[model samples]
Target: METKIFAKDQIDEAVALLREGELVAFPTETVYGLGAIATKEESVKNVYKAKGRPSDNPLIVTVSDEKMVERYAKSVPDRAKKLIKHFWPGPLTILLFVKEGSLPTAVTGGLKTVAFRCPDDKLTHDLIAKLGYPIVGPSANTSTKPSPTTAQHVYHDLRGKIAGIIDGGETRVGLESTIVDLSVETPIVLRPGEITPEEISEVLGEEVLINTGKVSDKEIPKAPGMKYRHYAPSAPVVVVDDVNDFAKIDFNDHIGVMALEDELDKIDLPKANKFNLGRNLVDADHNLFSGLRYFDDKKDITQIYVQGFNEGQASLAYMNRLNKAAGGHHF
Candidate 1:
């Protein structure tokens, strides 16, 4: 199949493709998402096939507004409403009870709950509004690969596999949305992103539990990244907790270092072998995946050493993705 690249304004072509049960990738603040109309079972299943994603790993439904969510969600709790007022059209995904038969099993992963988000991108919102229903959006890259923050990243990994890509340029957040499961009595964050649990707690005026335990292989993950390895490159990644640890490693041409600008200056590696992750945690969050992909393009990079931050000080979302990419390997 031919893979097309659409301009940000070219929503008609992408929407038409989706209407024909074809998959098209759309952008959000967090990441570019492979979109399939949520109600179309065949299209939704093809999304899993396209990404080689596990069938049981559910997808998040991308909607245009709260009304779209109300159409499918059994009931939106007051807490969810409060969160929506604060975080909707941003990087927050709310998991809610689904009305039976409202969405395809392929989308819900046969679970009674479904995740929904209204992206901040105007083009994406317009596309969804034009389509007249929600689209199941998982990160556009092939499963287990670094999530695509740019359209070129999507094209590199998924060209010819999906119908087309709506190029909305680079994503802002550079990570997935914070997923809060409101289906249960006590809201638990199934995944962390730009929106922290503390921020969510403050908005809802209640305690939000962060699920840190690994979901077993025998069990289906309630969220996309929970049960699988994700955001990894071809090279092995080592998390460097202390910048001073750079002195301990025997530097070689095959090693690539990703760290803050100042941290890179302290390292002895060649300038070509280092990728700057910028000044602070927010910059690191935005640059993380791009840095991983940068090294992937360098065939000689056998391993990657990335800067790590304390769980308390760093964005949990950034650390969560880095931990997965590194497979918990610390330097």
Candidate 2:
């Protein structure tokens, strides 16, 4: 279980490991992904077992380019094509109907549709290009853990459990990809990410539905990051909706406060170790998990309080991560 750091130049070794049914945690534009050959059943099952993830939680398949989508995916809907044209090699995952027996059943969670995306990172793109096939990747951490944004985060959670990690660098988006279901009549967004719904709506010239709720027993989970209470850190987390409420609430001296840059001064706890996420929503999305991890590392801090954003497309994914990190406690 000695995890090696496959530096950028060493991706060929990473590809070799993937081909041999060993898991490799590699960087993506969105986050570091625990990758295995999408077509290999043993490899895909190892991905789930490594993270202790539920078999029902689906994994997204990463392709080298757009054309490769057709090999595993039955067909890409018009709206998906338009979105991929604009956002491919970026952080958008499109759920398309899967070709029967083309992928390992573990990769799809026994579902008919497969989640696919082309990562923007050169190291990732080149790695997949060399492999010449799809790699099924979920976030490279234990199940329900904060998605790994850096190679160290991957190491922190999965060092001895996985085969190796490709240390391309810290992830750019620092969140999961925006996931949309294109197999159905009207496209539905099962998970929000860096790509906002408004942007998707404008491209398709039609409304995109957001369905981030939990799935039913009778229904299958359409995508990853949808059914689980994911992104939780090791500390106790609470979400404060209003920055103004910071002045009214009482906090201990050892508490760690995660707040927007504009509202850092608003938190009245004199001894609170404040971490500024950023002035706007975009910064919030980028720094949310890192901020949570920051607080988790501080043993002196007992409770970690976070500032929540008002509902909007820009803050949609930010809120989703924060809500889960806070364990659904938002006030």
Candidate 3:
């Protein structure tokens, strides 16, 4: 299970691994992705094996730009086009109806829609264009575990499980992409990431339905980071209803507190460690999982407590990861 870190100049060797129907861990602006040729059934299968991902959980296709988007999808509606004009080369992933014979059934989980995005990262764009195909790029980590934000995180989680590793340094955004489903009349937010529904609505002059935020069977997602346990750490976690409530808890064993920078001074438990995820939602969103990974790695912390953020644009993705990490274990 040895994981090797290849320089950005050596990314072609990683692409060669994908061309050979193997998986490689690489970086995107959002997070590290386990990449495989999206059209190659065997190569896509390797991504699942490498991450131990479930067959039912589908993968997202990463493309170079909007021109490539037309190659795989049957059609991009007007709404989707507007979104593309605004959000491509960023963290937004649009779900389009897959064209016949364009994508393998396994990659879509036998669904009619396929999620695709043009990443903002230079290395990721170069790799996709060089490989000359859309790639199945999922977060580079084991399923239901903390995502790999750094090359070492990938090496630690995916070593021996994949063919190669491309080190592009730490990810810019420590969260996954914002996924919008354009198949419906009103664009539905399937998964929230760095992009917010508010921003989408501002452009379209209408509200986007956020379906992923609800805890219901009908709202179950057809993509990764949905309908499954995710971003969890080894120790048990508790999400506090409010920052003031966090102060009431007694700290006996070494405690780990997950809070905003503003609340850091508010909680005063002795013999404790803290990871301040920034006071602003953007900074918090960008470092949520990496902070979780940091606390999860610390040997002294016995239990982790978290405080919820106010609902807003940047807070959307932050809450998603926190909910998954808390997993209903709120105090």
Top-scoring candidate (lDDT): 1
Over the stretch 1-331, how does candidate 3's per-residue lDDT look in tens digits? 4556789899878778778887888788899888888989987887888788878788999999888889999998888889889988999999999998899987998888899988889888898899999898899998888888899888878888887888888888889999988888888888888888889998888879987454445443566777778898887778886777876899655788877787877767652377888867677777778777877787777788877777666677877788888897778
How does each model score on lDDT?
A: 0.92, 0.85, 0.83
Clashes of each: 0, 0, 1
Candidate 1 vs 3: which has more lDDT? 1
Q: Could you tell which candidate, 2 or 3, scores higher by lDDT?
A: 2
| TM-score on alpha carbons, each prediction | 0.98, 0.95, 0.93
Candidate 2 ranges beyond 4 A from true positions: 268-272
Superposed on all Cα atoms, the candidates' RMSDs to the truth, in angstroms, are 1.0, 1.7, 2.2
Candidate 3 positional error at 126, Å: 0.3
Tens-digit lDDT string for candidate 2 (10-112): 9899989888889999998888999988888998888888999988888899998878898888887778889989998899999999999988789888899
Q: Give per-residue CA lDDT, model 1, range 212-287, as digits (tens).
A: 8888878877878999999999999999998889889998999999999998998888888999999998899999
lDDT of 2: 0.85
Instruction: Give the number of the best model, judged by TM-score.
Output: 1
Position 107, candidate 2: lDDT? 86
